[model samples]
Target chain A: MAINPLPPGAGTAIGIDGLIALLAKLPGLGPRSARRAVLQLIKKRESLMQPLARALAEVADSIRICSTCGNVDVQDPCAICRDPKRDAGLICVVEDVSDLWALDRAGLFRGRYHVLGGTLSALDGIGPDDLNIGPLVDRVRKGDIREVILALNATVDGQTTAHYITDRLGALNVDVTALAHGLPVGGELDYLDDGTLAAAMKARRKF
Target chain B: MAINPLPPGAGTAIGIDGLIALLAKLPGLGPRSARRAVLQLIKKRESLMQPLARALAEVADSIRICSTCGNVDVQDPCAICRDPKRDAGLICVVEDVSDLWALDRAGLFRGRYHVLGGTLSALDGIGPDDLNIGPLVDRVRKGDIREVILALNATVDGQTTAHYITDRLGALNVDVTALAHGLPVGGELDYLDDGTLAAAMKARRKF
Candidate 1:
């Protein structure tokens, strides 16, 4: 997304070129890779390319921001928010939909989610008002929520945003917790940083 | 394109998941990268995602394989084939449209192109009939073509296809040429292969 992915004479004018330009904007694909992707699409139009086009169209028209939880889905409240099995009283807060997908994919959480869209960052001028924090706090204030888990990234911006959200929901009579920071699963101890080593040692429990 | 790029429980059922699966089939994007791309798309639906969907639709509806030169474009004859500025008497034959694009991007060739679709490969079960070889020969038989330059890749399959095309058009009143083999521009001599070194030595000429 940072680099110009269009060729010498290519732009958004031609449909093929436009597709290439748009594909180039996606993460991990530069202009050359986009061109290769487009060529492969063209080569396999029936099996891959046309199907992808239809899928993109369908998602574009159907995918919506969940009014309750901020997850992008075909429904207003989202599939997770609508699910009867998921615990509505427990909400896992995340910085983005990507984070939501990651947590969901892992099958680590059985509760609903509240996507903040992004962490609060002064450098990028991202504030509380810009995110979906108000809706989250309102959901908690409506009173069924028993606990809020801060599943944000362990970065400065992530911690800052988590602290701010904690303060906002301080008077709501809900328990606020955070994900434990330690060596990740399958992580090599020798390759880990000092901070992680320290955290892992401090959080070590009896076997 | 080799690896199945999706995580567990992600597939072509849900719109977002479908988009991710389709994107994963692209050359470089796998399931995880596809998820990241889809998430990024969802995050910027208006500026990027929706536009990409629209472009894909437009291309799907408008793109046509050129009947004359086998190029994929908006026109049947293709823009290059229709252009009067290029030398119609000369044709550069390539294995695929991507090869054509690469050559065209260089701005080195002033003639039109003939895309073979693919080279003849016994391992892949590809024959001369599988490619657009007959059309190439037919084009030469029509008598306007003065020279047919084989610009296929410098692989065994490429050479075999080129030789097959040359033999097919041997009885015709046209000259068949091929791309010279030597050290590529900006390619270091120290890193060159023995075959390439031998070829470069054999093909050496006055500087």
Candidate 2:
């Protein structure tokens, strides 16, 4: 059985298998599907592959977490953090960068963002230090921010994180609110469609 | 409208936006999800992005379709085609390479494969000629191939494709057997778990 072996330095050096493996590491892609994607990308290289390569290289070179909010950005302070037009008085806190994207898609939330990086999880040993809570507290202490919206997932870890952030912000006198009970139990903000997110945001109640 | 003009040349020269756009072109990923993926890949570039980029390039350079079986491969005939242990006399007809992978995972049929590339669809103008049927017929006539398994999906289009191949193979005087009806209606072989697949093959009936 003269089965063709994978070429030397194939995946490690970057090849089809490497591409499939990399794509598989994404949130939803798997090995089999990643293979198909690699095939498709190859088939559409002129239109897709070269552009993708350049994009991959550029992101690899430039992307970094904003020191203030932990949002991935090309600049030191992300656009939202630096924009004076955005509502600095209101800070919207979220679990991940994806959550921020979901809120951005809704085209609401004129306020700036505070990405917590992740929720508190005793099971996973994630604590306040693991998250970007220090910068958030500093922003609150500056006295420009009057409200902090905890747009966290309704999971146990998410709620725990929300409560923890609330406690950290306790010394500051500010209105703390959360998205209302309209969010289905354990539903991720990313899974909620634009209309549902809009509704939940509109009906937010005091935490 | 103060979007910082997307930072000049970032619109098309390649970066997060371009990567997100390419990802969004995939079957299930959308622009919002694509952005999230790009971010994730950037964070894990050493383990993910670099390898993926290499794979993308290799596939872009080396991959193509098997002229005989329609399986996507690095070579013209594909690895399965050159495998001597596989029973060339028994041909398993499938809708696509994905189906071939499903059958391989089950490790049932030690036979060879003939990928139709796609199903027969009158509305979409797909017909037998559009598939690998002619080449399959040619192979059957040349080889000592005996049983041909119809492992196509249970969808109308899948059935239609199977029947088209069957009708074409009528003159070839070979036994044409189809996968069992135990497969749920409107079932796709890829979605079925391993046990069901094994059971289906064990109970496969005549066409």
Candidate 3:
């Protein structure tokens, strides 16, 4: 849908509309929902919008990709990567930061993470260079890393990416594990319940 | 849920978590949906966020309330009121801007608007001073306005607000009409299908 232009200030051309537009690009939103959201934000601007705007401005200013794991972070190395309490030897490789966050929410995985920006997609021409595979290989090559957890989604592309990473990490002589095949085929890691995720982690087998 | 703080440049301290927190305040959104939306925004930042940020900044800079119609506008009189083509003699009174926009989208009413901002709510301590009833009555008295359409929402508070305005406008000797009771109980004008709104308008009786 096209945004109708009005004489700037005399019409609805403002932050609220832009916020709604941005929100509409999300997975499960449309123009109507977006409009409703914007109106709500305006009605509660002081408590909601200001905090949101400040948060947005802050994120736009300081967000950076983690140098170690490629997770979105304020620092080069994300908190999970820098934490000494985490098991650095066991790196759970996930497709995106959201997946990493999901694993963190479970509070079961005390291991470090290797966020592969995205899965290997032949149709999309994504290859080893496009992901953090090189760094993952290097981290394993250091000989300190032991078990590498492949926590990719259950899609075909995800499986392909998992196999490719498995093969690469294989050459490094580290134990490779996939997070169980019973993770409901074609499901996203983010959609899995905590119990299911924990079960999958528990039932993980050597790939 | 607690917001996970990021290190320097992981984005901002508030970063995506901050954005999610802000978005969670919107109507019909909770923390889970907010997180999903924020992730989607970050993924499509180039295509969606850049333009959205510009729109937000622009709107944030210029948005204001239309002094005459009580509609949110960048100007005092608003485009609909200032437009010479729109029937200045016919004024459509609405409880909120959404109602005005809904009527405008129907493309049937070529009349000016009188936005009440909200309906009277005794529980919320809203009275005549809280709405634009005074200005609406004043407009009817000063302008050549003939028909005043009472397009208030079909709620107890909405009816109270409409009656209050109708009583005030009655003094100006204008023909006051309300959209018919064809609207569903507790239904918002914005949710009515276009045809229903049009039919309701055509079947409107005197208030």
Superposed by TM-score, candidate 3 places the C-alpha of residue B161 at a distance from the truth, in angstroms, of: 3.0
The DockQ scores of all candidates, in the order shown, are 0.40, 0.28, 0.36
Lowest summed lDDT over 10 consecutive residues: which window, candidate 2 chain A? A7-16
lDDT of 3 at A122: 83
Candidates by lDDT, descending order = 1, 2, 3
lDDT of each: 0.87, 0.78, 0.76
User: Candidate 2, which segments miss by more than 4 Å at Cα?
Assistant: A1-22, A30-54, A87-90, A120-123, A139-207, B1-14, B30-39, B143-148, B154-177, B180-207
Please state how well chain A of candidate 1 matches the true chain A, as a TM-score. 0.90
Candidate 2, A111: how far from true, in Å? Answer: 3.6
lDDT of 3 by residue, B24-91 (tens): 77776788887787777666666765565555555555666778897765555666666767888998
Candidate 1 displacement at residue B144 in angstroms: 1.9
Top candidate by lDDT: 1
Report the error of model 3 at residue B91, Å. Answer: 1.1
Off by over 4 Å in 3: A1-20, A123-125, A181-207, B1-13, B122-125, B183-207
Quality of candidate 3 docking, DockQ: 0.36
Candidate 1 Cα outliers beyond 4 Å, as residue runs: A1-13, B1-13
DockQ of 1: 0.40
lDDT of 2 by residue, A1-207 (tens): 344575422322344455666788887677876767765676687888877776676677777677878777766577667666778799899988889978976888888888988888889998889888888899899857889999999788998888988898998989899987667779999888886788789888899
lDDT of candidate 3 over A1-207, digit per residue (tens): 233355433354444445666767766678777777766766665666556656665565566677888887766667666766788789899998889889988899998888998999889998889988998898889749889999999788998999998878676778999876557888899988887788789878899
